[model samples]
Target: MKTLIILLFFSIISIASAHAQSNTPAKAEQEIIKLSKTKWDWMADKNVDSLSTLFDEKAVFVHMGGSWGKEREIAVIKSGSIHYKKADIHSVSVNIIGNTAILLNNITLLAVVGGNEVSNPFIVTEVYVKQGKGWKMGSLSFTKINQPAQ
Candidate 1:
């Protein structure tokens, strides 16, 4: 019985993964894209409460200057240390792998850091994991782009 149960679970996982890899962007892909866009708005507004709910407990955030976990990220936003003024997204793409989603956004971000306003192009990568009925952000990483935004 135990062996059979394990095999069944693996089969389910295999089916889920295969389904997620389909070329057509399905509802799940749309959902992830929308979630990522909303996340930008939350950051711009400094809505730590909403962001806190979206981010997983073990979420990791990576920036040009440093990298930190969820708690520190919330603290930083709440303290107004790095104010996300706006994000002008050029393009966005998402790939769902089983219960995990990887989203990429090419954007030009306007932010106030250390009381100085700056704008920079970045390729932001967001990883989300579906837990229960909702998705939680597991990682957010920003990679600066030297070229102009397309």
Candidate 2:
């Protein structure tokens, strides 16, 4: 009777552990979404210090015009080159692979550069990795959307 009871207890524990493991993807997705919004807010306010905190130490950013490391990206933000008049993001999808996550999103960027206004639709992919206590973006890439040919 005692052996049967022990077996049942172990079985229950195993099932609970499996259920917890299955929720990992959903939890990771939520974390990424929250991180993305926070970073966007920081960008909207032009707070380079706050924005830099979202990126990992070895993060890489591949922008439409250029590519940069974490330090270089922060430097440009500090230089006040990339200013957002109205930046909106939507259609965010998150996928997880082991400890890495990929977040794909569409963005509408409205800005003024050298007195010329520019508004464009762009697709962005941000890679995040779970490091230490929280998740930090490890890489970011953006591409412009071209209109269909008539």
Candidate 3:
């Protein structure tokens, strides 16, 4: 009888663990969403310190003009070469697979590039990799939308 009770207790714990694991994706989605929004804020403010920490050392950034790595991206922001004035996000979606999160943002971005202000609609893809207890952005690619209307 005591052995049966022990077995039942372990079974209960096992089921509980499985249930918790099932809910992990939803929680991870929210975390990624919040982190992405915060990243936008950092970009708009040109807060390179926060952005540098959030971005992976080998992170890649793709823009309409060209693509570059993390250091160049940070330098551009610091120099006001590409000032991310604002990002009007229309929609966002996140997918989590293992230790990777891919986020898509539909936004109308207003920015200053080479001292010229421009607003463009873009679908931005951001890939983040979970490292230990922290998440770092691995890639940011922007695809321009042809249609003007949001």
**Which candidate comes out best when scored by TM-score?**
3
Model 2 score (lDDT): 0.81
Write candidate 2's Cα lDDT for 1-150 as tens digits.
999999999999999999998987898899898888777777667788776777888999997778989998887666657665665786799999988999887888776654577887878788999888788889988787884111
- Badly placed stretches (over 4 Å) of model 2 are 147-150
For residues 57-115, what per-residue lDDT tens digits would candidate 1 score against the true structure?
99999999999999999999988899999999999988888899999999999999989
TM-score of each: 0.84, 0.88, 0.94
Give all candidates' CA lDDT scores. 0.94, 0.81, 0.95
For candidate 3, write residues 4-49 as lDDT tens digits. Answer: 9999999999999999999999989999999999998999999999
> How does candidate 1 fare on TM-score?
0.84
Q: Is candidate 1 or 3 superior in TM-score? A: 3
Please give the lDDT score at residue 27 for candidate 1. Answer: 88
- Number of the predicted model whose lDDT against the real structure is largest: 3
Off by over 4 Å in 1: 1-25
Worst lDDT 10-window in candidate 3: 141-150
